[model samples]
Target: MTSRANRSRNNRCATALLVATTLVLAACKAQAPTPQPEPATPQVTADTSAQPARSTDAPLPSEDASLAPAVTTPALPSAFVDKVWKVSKSGAVEPGTTYVFLADGTLVIDSPNGTPMHGRWSFDKGALVMVEEGISYPTEIIAIDDSQFHIRSHNPGEPVDIELVPAPDQPLPKP
Candidate 1:
């Protein structure tokens, strides 16, 4: 009789413990998770009108214009102005190459071979044109943001997607 009493008590304790654990788990599962807010996206619009032809001798806008509180110039996006961009991938140009678009229409390219090439750059119809030695090479800006840009070369061949990233090491040209 004593042994039977002890066995009954142990069974009851085990059942109680199992019930408590199940109730605790159920309470945890009943609680709702907090909702997360969606990320805000920047608004961007495209201009389809024809732009006036810019002369190679004509200088670009000042750097202050890009940083101004209001939008004044429509020639180039503010993100592209006064930025040192590095070619992440390209067929014609080698990777790890750096390019700087100055506020004075000067395009400086530092190749991996340590050769620095100087050219004139301009933005027309969502495309960036770089002219060197009277030869014009235009690249279409597929997408651009504050940090990076995607460009497609107009050269006839295997169309390679070129990604340009902000080069913090390369400083922007003085205004």
Candidate 2:
């Protein structure tokens, strides 16, 4: 009788120890960090100045630029203002229209049909606003580089999104 009781007690102790070890192992595994995949490196192309343009499928006025406080002299990107940009796709401006952003904050738009349109452009806090004639266009610069200048104009009735590419070297417009 005594031997049988001793054997039963020993078996229960061993089973309890096994259960505790398994629980601890499970808890540790739950807390372990998972391995993450490494990021792929960017490929270099012949035209290093060019980058893929963003999709303009979405409607304009993604963000309100009017709420942004006015700036005295908005700092425009040197690369964007340096070259003339030709419009490829737009809702407001005609296709093939050329744009020149001067260092003195002059925005010149040369439409194929009419005379050059003069406007004042400013960029501050990622908000670009252009004033021409008597209308204000709050513009969002989607992307700008040496090769491309894409923007979305927040015109009240019909918001215009435009894609522009670097045009051939041309003479700077008169101030």
Candidate 3:
């Protein structure tokens, strides 16, 4: 009967399916696991934008360069807090990032549209330290002074120094 023939055909099909699954599992077990790629090392670039051009006639701060007491924290005044400051960094002119300083003391930084994108920044050793994040040309620019930020990208080549002048009435970093 046709029903008997169909039952036999289905059994054969079921056996074929089981065999196929077993072979797939065996093949998967035979293959070795792929290794993950190592993370790329960070390339340090010298950003001289923070670098000051000490005038030959300019006098130094003090005869004794002493370190501040660890207990004493010299605070950046709240007068500039919760305000936006326009930054020209790493040899680049205006149209830079606007850092909004909040009262609680966090920073909200806006990225530059046209210029090279600098990375994340935090105050380190009294100056701003920037690490290249999600940027096309990964650059780590450090703040040298109020007007200068500098860094050179070893990966991309060519050291870049940026000069940043604070735009008047710019909001301070967010709290």
Candidate 4:
């Protein structure tokens, strides 16, 4: 009878030890996950009413040699390259204003004042992104062809539809 009692006590102690071990293992495994960095928010100014000062001789966006290899600029479509397009109709840009998109991703906006506005241009995420004087405008390309290009501004209040026709003398870039 004493041996039976000792066996029962030993079994209880073994079960308690197993349970304690399992609890300790579970506590160690249940850790808070490491935090991840947030995505960068683009810096945009609120003064959308004022026109940015044109800088014809402005240097291109600086490219660091070390970072250039990792950073790849999405190429503009071949059909839109090296062409001078004029605004046939638009509320954003003055009608008859010419915009030249060079193959090297340089955008030349011939302002109504006749001063050329130089800026960097790139096609990103299915939108044509134009950055001028630190302001970035991502406009949706409605359609494009050898003859005409249509674009819609992302502005909510003053939404603009710009129609662009190729310059008479300028021809489409060779594929």
Superposed on all Cα atoms, model 3 deviates from the true structure by an RMSD in Å of 20.0
List ranges where model 3 is wrong by over 4 Å.
1-83, 88-90, 93-119, 134-156, 168-175
Q: Give one digit per residue, the lDDT tens place, for model 2 in 1-175.
A: 9999999999999999999999998887766577888898897665311222334673433465553322112324675774688998876678888888888988898988989999888766646778888687887666665667777777888778899988876667886
Clashes of each: 0, 0, 37, 0
Backbone clashes in candidate 4 total: 0
Q: Flag regions of model 4 displaced more than 4 Å.
A: 1-76, 155-157, 170-175
Where does the lowest 10-residue lDDT sum fall in candidate 3?
Answer: 67-76
Give one digit per residue, the lDDT tens place, for model 4 in 67-175: 2221122223676668889899887789878877777878787866787778877875545777776677777666676777777666547757888988867544322
Candidate 1 residue runs with Cα over 4 Å from true position: 1-75, 156-160, 173-175
Q: Give the TM-score of candidate 1.
A: 0.51
Cα displacement (angstroms), candidate 4, residue 25, comes to: 51
User: 76-98 in candidate 3: lDDT tens per residue?
Assistant: 33323444556555444345666
What's the true lDDT of residue 123 in model 4? Answer: 72
Alpha-carbon lDDT, every model: 0.70, 0.73, 0.48, 0.68
